[model samples]
Target: MSEHPIELSTRMIDTGVVDTPSNRVTEELSELADGVAIVESFSHVVAVRTDDGLVAFDSSGSGSGAQVVEALRRWDDDPVHSIVYTHGHLDHVGGSAAFAADAEDRGRPRPRVVGHERILDRFERYELTSGYNRMINMRQFGGAARSARRLDERPFLPDATLRPDVTYEDHRTETIGGVEIEMHHCEGETDDHTWSYLPGFDMISAGDQFIWNFPNCGNPQKVQRYPVEWAESLRAMAAKGAELFVPAHGLPIAGRDRIRTCLETVATTLEDLVADVIEAMNAGAVLDEILHTVTVPDEALDLPYLQPLYDEPEFVVRNIWRLYGGWYDGNPARLKPAPDATVGAEVVDLAGGIDRVIERARATSTAGDHRLACHLIEFAVAADPSSPAVHEARRAIYAARRGGETSLMAKGIFKSAEADSTTVIDGEAPPLRMIRDLGD
Candidate 1:
């Protein structure tokens, strides 16, 4: 949108813009240093020129892969020496096939795709949970929120997705064209995450571990994240004294001091959250109490790099508890809880009817208690899921909920809920489950 992607990114970074064009893949290449550059994509491709060829970190994504390769070609035709996966996330590594295809077209051996040893397991798990991934991803980004559209039955790890050819245990160091690159495994967003550093350039190619947003160790839809170790990894990268800091998803920072502040602030935020959550747990507070009572420093959140735009702090607290404790939230009623519909039907009977509950939910929502309003609406929907009136209220309430949220995670989920209700109101045969209920 600006003259250049980096300019756009830097402007957003300086102005504290969370909805950034940097996250968009333009398939344009910009050089940061001699023989080093970045290809702007959904997940960027950071390349280092080597006598052997080009060493690239991350390959955009499946849909954007071909464009990313084309963008890099416009800058340099050097065959890719290697492609490093910052992590196994689809956006980061999904484009590996394009890189391999390019190598074949140029009559060269495929670039070695390198990643942590756990990546294979991650891929395997994707295969096992493809439906779930499709559901969550659609909710996270597609605004599909339990939509009636057919979920993709194919494996989430597509045939185009490439497994890492070069795997390392914890740390791996090697020289590509005489420049040393260090890859270190850090469990944060993903257990198999790796961040690379080039001492020669004093630049760190931080994977999602240091995304511009608050540490994504709190992605509610995903697996257990390592916040404690995530902070440790950020500190480790900061201690490297890197001059140029390139993250997988945001603006590349140039100054050493700026880079250190970002790394330390994010690390400190996580460390503080961990300490507070653990203290609350030790003091015999339930998970709900800790969730409501926990507070993140406003100062930390005010920092550009530490914005809770994607994953916020409270989710991080829940993740911390999950890591240290079990799924049991210390609520005996929920330990072996009755089904929502059963409980909601009972509540509806005591409260007069579903209509009365919906009216209260509307008032709660009007009073700016969207959280409580959603709860009441959910109970109403559970009690009489087929009622158009209940769904209409759900649609409006969730739209309000989505509007008030800052983080993408919260917004996406709320938007999806809104979409779900909208679907029923529109009467497009609802998600198959709803149709089945109608038949019953």
Candidate 2:
């Protein structure tokens, strides 16, 4: 791997070369300014030395949270005065326990945990939908989902999540260790997102708002994301004229001009997407038509930071429709549609038999129409679940779909489908059962 593994890896995955100047990640503590430093863990943690003590932003992911604390100790042993959570996502806030434990070990006061007021609601929802989150995450991150599971068998959001002791509704300014820190709430990847700015150092800790990849405004497996407001928030941060930009998931950026251009470009890409999507929705375009019509400019997509690595633009279009147009996809037939298996049985009968349907699915996949091939193969599988040929075709089609995907979320979902077909072919237990067992 190259020194900047993420940039090198992305180049290989996106353009088959290592030339683009992508986000740089370093294992050691990197100082962004006089008092600001960052530890690049699974999710980076930002630390600011204040007159009273140290103010930290985020604690990395749960598995690496303790390690992050250790790394920070190596750099500076100032007792943590406060920790600000940018959001309630597991990766950003799941490591609070380690921070708390560190405080106790050092005989220091428990660091005050602060975050958006909606953070409590997010944690409550996570508890309520633990199983669903586990399933979705399994299909979103593939095999790595196993490590994300908590000891309590819940995956993604763990039971150890630390709720904010101090909550702010839209904006809050705190003088921590004599350093003024401003927290501004915005709806982006999560409703409970907070971006912090320090005027003393002219630095912005942008949580996940400026993750190096395309803005993750369209996560297919998760809740609704605010793209319109997300863009607006980025613009707000850009107007701050911060000299150093630090994101929760990627390397820190220095230089005011470089930071401003990056922020504006991301904002413009999302702004264009939201505008096109809302325009199509107002014109009464259906979801499918809207998806085809609203598109991010190819020039924007070509930007290294805007590449679709974690989430794609097409998914964002669907999210926009969902936000504005409701669940009805404008297809009357699907309003009160029959069960998928029942519809598949009808299609299989119309196509003669399962074998014939499988043959056509294989041909379609061979012709590079994997989407249509998967649709046909799904019907064949539903029509005759016991057919080995149908299962083989289903597996092959989904594998092809997985191979063509750019986003990790898309690939994981396709891989899950392929895994299901393999489970049936190998005479193993159902995929859901396996997932449940893994959680246990």
Candidate 3:
């Protein structure tokens, strides 16, 4: 048995994060709506009553905004005075149009929309990377990528831009209807994240910075993230001494000590992880070599709050490398490389035909050597996508790989292989696993 108990647990589990699947709206919404009324499209919504009207934050990405609006209707018809966005992620701002439309109908003041100045730039970049974004969304949502719809328009745009409206360079204190909101800007999971502190009520909304899982500073398909800066931000928030810390993605945390310890541990782990990677790089270790060598401290990884469910420390190391150093990993072969298929075909030919590669892949896969099996099968498939043996080998490798995975990135890669394979993996399995026993 592993020494660490938290390795088998997650922030959602340790903190007792529960979103009971109910036809009923969230109790937070149910209670808050009793007077000023606010609905959240998805399960994650925060509503606070101010002197002027109600201010609601974030409509969930899954089109649950209508449910939130309806829940608010049950409470009161008082217009939504404001809607503040923590960041520009699709999940955070995808359902704004519905609430905006509702607020328009009552001759009630249109909710003044607010977000960081960089959000507009964030949206435009999404427009540029629409195709890539579509592919990633398909993987995240477990569906075929949205090919027919315009990715740019598919994500709803915010109104009355906060591009500069009520913008703060570092921090700002704003009171809406007598409710004091302390705004602090920090770059973490996203470049444009803003955390709101309701000092009067002793509540804070942490946006993506303190997402229940590991800090996702190293997403495989997204822009560069600042892991070191992210750690600093987490420390800053922890120092605020908030009584209630409500995160954008998971359950709300009550009590100062719990919130502070959780956030500080995340910060310390990341800053140390970055230092580890930097030390390895300074010693002239290459990227792949460093990935195999560097590791976050065991104590940090064992923390319930820092599970690598979505992203891993190695990914963060890679991001840091990209930020400070160029893409060159000091490898001459990759400096001016041939296309992937060309290289794969050469590898397959050297292995004495595709059949030999397939056979070897099957043996490796059966032996639970998925990393090796994946490389062999991927080369075989890439060299000849139409070959039945290649397809079979790829499917077998993918299925074997899925069984040993923990992080979301690994699962997504295996799932993509399954999707492209001629034969699917036999049965669906959960991604949750014990992390400590599987060690460096």
Candidate 4:
């Protein structure tokens, strides 16, 4: 057998350097154990053979659904009898239509789609906010992630979304084709998340819980995430004594010990953040004070799986505050804040003129003060949006900020800003208005 993902992760831990993200979605299928195979895609599709037919966990996304089915056919021709969703995320459930089509073509009935009861509510919410979700996807993903087919774009949660046919509240166990599947409801990335385990196979199909990056509990563009409950779920999975751990997005790990260690490490890091943030919150600390003071230990972050590739810990701090503290942000003036443009104009006026603000912005940027440079550039732009010189400086400053970020979330937003300034300069568009930028 090829080197298991666990072996690679183990070596990475030993070297103290993460070579790549654990959430790569290359479309390929590999079996780490007998009768079980994992298809790596935008989200992984884990196929388990059973006497009744094939039981697949997560069918991949709409873009890779056919590829997932093709890979499974090359390995095992069993008709998919049941497809389990790890959550309501499009990447996790988008491929169910493809699976259903495959079954129909083979003279078999459609596979039963299964997930947590809250998934139904999630689908309803997506339908209600499809327009906003579509816009968010375009900004956040740059390319059309909301569209299933790259060229033929669809709505964010298109009418074609395959809603779950079976739903559970907390925990459920059932025998399918003589093999038992245990599904536990847990909230982490989504309120409707579910992690499944196969007792006989000694494997856990952990949805997005243990993705190789820091738990994406703080995605700025996304809704509220549960860091407190996220840590608890990881601990529960670790106690299962599973020999194989398959995640929906990243590399699947092998060996009971390796699985436990990786899960425990991820759990502890999150638990630590929650504890530190809550303690600060309890002391009546303002969000700004807690944000600047609280930090994840360098050692914990240096671990292979704990790398901040997708979402960093700083955003997580903000999310924790949002969950318990409400949106006031502790700034008295911001509570009933003036327009962003109005505030920027005031800052520029304080600096004497738009020209002075632009000069300082460029100088501060060159002096390795990119953060302050950005604020100054925004002030200059607000004061004189038609200035080509200021726009060029804004583009360069945001590009520099993008270069210094580690997480994809930060990089994308900064890149979006850089691109926006470029558009204003190149197209001679009207003064750039700051919209929520998404990444390419």
Candidate 5:
């Protein structure tokens, strides 16, 4: 029996400035074991304890982490000895310092951080897209996407990296604090998600692999993930005879049969989506065409656990394309794209006058159609960026659609665009265009 008990915390909050409704939505669903208490750090700190020691997880450190430690204090004063990170996402890995600090004060063994080997790479990718990420985060919080100011540095780095700390080429087993645990490496959600099983408790802690919402197979802003691999992982977990399932986000699921059904349903949905996407690609369809073509069956969509609260099927299709096709979408016009202004100006001339486009934009915005309105306004803005009418129209259209958005990822981008259009109206310089200029 292992001496150190791994931890899980239920406490989490939006550490960033603009908190989305989804943040709260996700929080209300987090759960831990019965005898083993759950703690809330910021809004998402999660931890668990056993006979040996404590094991905690999540990244809402500082305020969030402090809250988690306080919650644990409500139960036992035992020091935490093990920390398991589900993946490298900021909210999951950011709160380590506070927990480690408290454990230090108690003279408990310093918590050993564990995570997938790819966490380091995840951090590097975040740094590379810092400007874009910062903007998205601001939008996610309902703040301005870009600041004329500078970076805030909230997206932190992980310490005590795990080279599969316990190491699993595919699946591996370990016993922490006398709690029999199983860890499986999955390529879903994030590239190296760890789905853990505690046999003694008949509980399964599926990191992001099995969230209550529809699988986040199609995150709009992040890199590619393997849908096939994700499906396989879900099926593998469903086969486990766990009576209790604690998802990283959302409610706890009980009963072996129900859990198996939920797991199987998500797995099948992803598999179908991937198969359909690949079939479309094989038919030589472009990315946009493929995205518009693939659809999730209403049966799967109807599942309460399969809500599209985070990501949609279209985004997953695009991610799959990236996995197979790299950056270029095989369109020769985009092989070496011209500047937006250059293309927009030519397109505007072809469509007649810029005023004609703005008139169409006004019409679309008036009809309560932001998607078309934004498309028209983007051309006008890119070409005749100084037009106040165009700016106001863009801002208004985005605002109308913003509240209707469901996922934080989607709301963030749309809100940011709205803010940028307003900034242009207020005589503030917009963000550097190079941020979204793919080749740039």
Candidate 6:
């Protein structure tokens, strides 16, 4: 098992040292300035001490919340005056209940919860699609069916989520404990993302906008992200010229020039991608053609921070097409196409038989054409799902695909597919696995 909560084969992006410790297990609490400190949890929680009380940005994820609160208490026992959420992502706001509970125990009044008004809508959506979210998350994280089933038994949105008591439209400035925080709302990873700036400290708390890795504007399973506006928001942050930059997911960065370069490079990457896709659209190019043609420059990709470790640029191009072009993929036949199973059956018939199709899939996989291999295997399974030979081959092919994938999202989904094939071969109830001793 990896030491980091989020594991990646790639090396950590090379951002200048801002004093983040190597030991993430201990939750290093680094004091950036006189009254400011950051608790480096899965997602960081920033605490700013003011004359009146403590003002915190993000509570961290569910169980991590209590740990963050304890870390903050160790630094200073000031009552939390307010909690500002950067967005509605569970990791950012799940810990709100812990902060509230700590305040109550200390005999202090409830801290004001502030966020973009759309956060309420996000929570409501989660409630409505709890089952669907669980299934996708299982695929997203490559967890077993038992894990997803456990999640289904509970509420998707935690009861501990402290909804925003105060909401804003575009921007708002609040004075908490004599410290002023300027919150600016913009469309990015989520519609409700807010980037806060503290004039007194010359610091900017960029929610998910400036995470150390590549910008997550192209999550495959998530709702629509704003690439065009995401670029605009980054440009706006670069213009702030803040000395200290605090991101929700990564270590804090100090120095104006380093911060500006990081922000501008990310902005330019998004802007160029958007422009290239838009140009292809104007030429009446189809979705597949656009995806193949539009590309991020090598200079941008070479930037350690802009690496495609989480969400790649290809997914972002598809998102732009979805935003502007709607669901039609410029292919009339697909507008109201037959079900995939029906199409697969027909393809199998034309390809001769299930055995032939499986053979072709293995050859395609060996030849480094995993995408074509997947299509062939899908047809084989759909046409003859009862065939033990086909299922075994399907499992092997999917495992190979998973091994070759770079993005966690792709790997997780491929792993899920491999697991599904294993279930069929083992003759277990769909999604159920037989347990074995560890040493076995």
Give the number of the best model, judged by lDDT: 1
What C-alpha lDDT, on a 0 to 100 scale, does residue 262 get in candidate 6?
80
Q: What lDDT tens digits, residue by residue, belong to model 5 across residues 1-440?
A: 11111211111111212222222322222234565544422335556676667776554544465556666666666666677777877666666667767877877766776766677677788767766666565566564646532556644344432222443456667777777767777888888688787778788777778765678877766667788999998888888878877665654566787778778888888888888888988899888788777888876665556767677776787888888767778688998988887776777898898888888887887787877787887887777665667778778777777777766667777888777777778876655672343232
Better model by TM-score: candidate 2 vs candidate 4? 4
RMSD of 5: 6.4
RMSD values, in order shown: 2.2, 4.4, 8.0, 3.7, 6.4, 5.7
Model 1: runs farther than 4 Å from truth? 1-24, 428-440
Each candidate's number of clashing pairs is 0, 2, 5, 1, 38, 0
Query: lDDT per residue, candidate 4, 1-440, as tens digits?
Result: 44455566667765776666555566767876899998878788999999999999988888889999999999999889899999998887888888888888999999988899998988888878777676555555652222221234456775565788899999999999999999999999989999998998999999899887888999888899999899999999999989888888777877788888888989989988989999998999999999899999998888777888879999999999999888888899989977766777788888898878888988888888888899889877766665678888888887787788888888877776666566667754532254321111
Task: Find the 10 residues in a row with the least total lDDT in model 2.
Answer: 143-152
For candidate 1, write residues 1-440 as lDDT tens digits.
34564565556666766554445556778888777798878888899988889999998788889999998999999999899998899998888899999989989999888899999999999988888898888888867847533555666777878788889999999998988999999988989988999988888999788777788888899999998898999999999999888888877877787678778888888898999999999999999999999989887787667778899998988888899988999999999998777778898999999989999999999999999999999888777777789999999998888889999999998988888888778865455444443334
- Comparing 1 with 4 on lDDT, the higher-scoring candidate is 1
What's the CA error at residue 188 for candidate 5, in Å?
A: 0.8
User: Model 4: which ten-residue window has the lowest total lDDT?
Assistant: 431-440
lDDT of 3 by residue, 19-112 (tens): 3311123423434222322232234667777778877776555356666676666665667777777888876776666676677777665577
- Candidate 2, TM-score vs. the true structure? 0.91
Q: Which residue pairs collide, candidate 3? A: 39-68, 40-68, 41-64, 41-65, 51-177
| Candidate 2 residue 293 C-alpha distance from true site, Å | 2.9
List candidate 4 segments past 4 Å from native: 1-6, 14-17, 143-153, 428-440
Score every model by TM-score: 0.94, 0.91, 0.83, 0.92, 0.85, 0.90
Q: Which stretches of candidate 2 lie over 4 Å from their true place?
A: 1-27, 143-152, 431-440
**Model 3 regions more than 4 Å off:** 1-43, 143-168, 423-440
Name the best candidate (by TM-score): 1
Report the Cα lDDT for residue 306, model 4. Answer: 81
